[model samples]
Target: MHPQYKADKPIDCPICSMKLVKFEPTPNGENKPMDSMPGMDGSSSSTSSQASNNTIYVDPQRQQLIGVQFAKAITKPLSKELRVVGKVSFDETKITHIHTKVTGYLENVFVDYVGKPVKKGDPLFTIYSPDLVATEQEYLLALRSNKELSKSSFEEVSFGSSSLLEATRKRLKLWDISDKEIEELEIEGKAKRELTFYSPVDGIVTERAAFGHGKFVNPEMDLYSIVDLSTVWIIGEVYEYEMSFVKLGQTVEIEMPYSDKKSLYIGKITYIYPVMDAKTRTAKIRIECKNPQYTFKPEMFVSMKIKINLGTHLVVPEDAVMDTGEEQYVFVD
Candidate 1:
């Protein structure tokens, strides 16, 4: 090409001085950089016009077009919350099994149904026992003998009828026959055919095996399984790897599956099971919680979160983060 042709079209490779050809591999319709080259003046005509039109004047002394990127150096704190799922349970220690001390037929069950709440000394059932009747008769005879012997001519009662009467009264007491029952027997001068059994603990009856309206019960058979609802047990199922964060005393936030509302409860790691579930790879941790309102029910599912402070470390917004697996990165503006 002659100098006149080059000056008019200016479509020649600067290095090799060849005719310019466009490349179509890019989104830009034309790629004319194949032949374009900077002149001896160290300037480009196309970019110069854009710089003058969109330049930002930072100070009166200088002006420059604002670029779309910036960078910041920061240190982020790594605070993590570990989430686990667990179930609510009754505190094993607070559970009581009301059993019969003496075998007898359950003539009447006043509180036979399950889920009945009872307090200490509350009548639970009535038992008709031949043995109790005979004992009561002996107590009555001892009482009458004491009154008769006191009037004896002998200054000192040889057998000590007063002592015998006291011992007899104690026998009934040992059988958990309430003082009221014993007093009634004392006043009425008759044996109570049916003894009313009272609850030994304040709790709800979770299990009961009253043999119908009229059934026999043995000392070995559990008459009723009572559980105190005032306090409950929370079993936290934590991953084996995350078990280190769980200690003897840790504050936990419990959220019920039914609703998003959370309950804050302080728990002590009273028990950590020695073994982990082979398939689930989770360890069982028992926590004691007070259910003052009895709102927490047994077998209820709950989500637990254990907060862990990893100390102050670096962090970045999720949107600004780019994870390459081997390295984490953030785009500098």
Candidate 2:
């Protein structure tokens, strides 16, 4: 067998079953250097080849000519990085679902479309709730009675009237009536037939359940969903084997493959979903990112890399190992 090629001890060709033969080099300087096969070292013309039981000796010239390289095995901090596909999602903690406390017919709708930007106090819709109007009327009647009885000779009578007025005022407030509206009611001495609802926060309306004018609605009906995209969530998945490296509050690098900037965004893992996908066998992790300029949109796909330190360990070049099916080996020199 040649020093560089693997062969069975019986010295027979596996394919043709031909008996193998061995040959030695000719007299020195008698022949040009033989061509070398790819992956195998180039033939050395400087000196004849020499081999022992399991190792071959190649001179420095031939080793350098074939681009043979060496790397020192060392102990160093190591980290494993996994690139994964992630999708943008709404930060559930920052989402507000608009629901009415009163049952009534929608009188007017201001925020009628999804994707509309709204401020914290922007009016969302108005409802003509007979119940709301009735409560306001009761407040006005109590207000008038309290004034008329304040000068009463009996302290009990005056106190009772004041108590009734305060109770009615509290009821309206409980129904989500703004203090400004209550003051307007006091000045006007009348109840508003249509009670307007306003947005609770500055956000974009990702969902709107506009029931239309004159359509009856109740507390069970979801009127709108305002999402504050200034802070968003990214949902990513990692293989089960990589789950050990992930942790809550771990920082991750996020990149949008479709974006022109190719900029990297930073985020922290806020949640690790308990559900493991049966098909993909991956666990979902939620990362919270500040969406400056509303950069991330729901359902937008992005790429992310999760890096986890593995402490100190010895390492070698990837090219060092050569696998032979059942076993693996490497050339020492």
Candidate 3:
């Protein structure tokens, strides 16, 4: 292993201290280390023309001949960005389901078409329920009886009539009858033929089951589905190994697949599904976002980015050891 002479025949490798072996010249023909043990030394440190603890210490001349480059490993902050495909969906909490409290035929529908925007207390439809009419007549009769018993000397008669009136009013309310309608009925002294149900919230009707002048509906039927689009949910899937980086309240950036390319939606992680998909081996994460003007559509595809910051860690350049598979390192010179 002397620098003054070259080994033309079989000789022992000084560095490996093994049996006889012949050295093949490097690409540059500069004398390389007799033997190199990958991952034995840190990326950078002082070196001499000696191998210690299986660390290959190359001299400056040999280092130049082999075009050796050294980089000092340093501690620095790093971050990883996860790019994934996401799907836009309605926030379940913001979705409102319309159902009738009583069975009846739809006499008239104000919100006749899907995608119609409606506010709280807006008329949805009118129903002609014979039972509702009978209930209304009972309420009127109770009202009259209570008024008659108002001056009765017997407190028991007065209390009995007042209780009947209250019970009738409560039944009407339970049937989705508004207080305004009850007041109007009291003044008119007659039950209206049609009972109208109002929109329970400010939202856009996404689905409708009632139509025409005679659509029979009951409590079990889903008359309409209205969704408040001000807030939406974006569900994204990440690899099983990457699930550790996902956490609640982490900010995420969203880009629509078919909309304006320049526009980006900001959102935050609201939930992380505990189960992983068996087929794709990915975990689902839900992000909540504000959708102004109904910018997000249900079932639409989107791209999402989530950046995870990793604390300061000792790192080096990207390089691989030839024989060593996982463990990689560099020589010190």
Q: What is the lDDT of residue 327 in candidate 3?
A: 63
Residue 68, candidate 2: alpha-carbon lDDT: 72
Deviation in Å, model 2, residue 238 alpha carbon:
0.4
Task: Report the C-alpha lDDT of model 3 over 1-333, residue by residue, as the tens digit.
Answer: 334444577665475443333444544454454445443433432332344665554554454455566778879999999998999999999999999988889999899899999999999999999899999999999999999997899999999999999999999999878788899999999989998898999999999998989888899999999999999999899999888888899999899767756688899999999888999999999999999888788998999999899989987776622335876555444
How are the candidates ranked when ordered by lDDT, highest leading? 3, 2, 1
Q: Write model 2 residue lDDT over 146-187, tens digit each, in one string.
A: 999989999999999999999999999889998999999999
Which lDDT value does model 2 have at 161?
98
Quote the positional error of residue 319 for candidate 1 in Å. Answer: 9.7
Task: Show where candidate 1 strays beyond 4 Å.
Answer: 1-78, 150-159, 260-268, 313-333
Error of 1 at 70 (Å): 7.2
- Report lDDT (CA) for all predictions: 0.74, 0.83, 0.83
Ranking by TM-score: 3, 2, 1
lDDT of 3: 0.83
Model 3 bad stretches (over 4 Å): 1-33, 36-50, 59-62, 320-323
For TM-score, the strongest prediction is 3
Candidate 2 TM-score over all chains jointly: 0.77
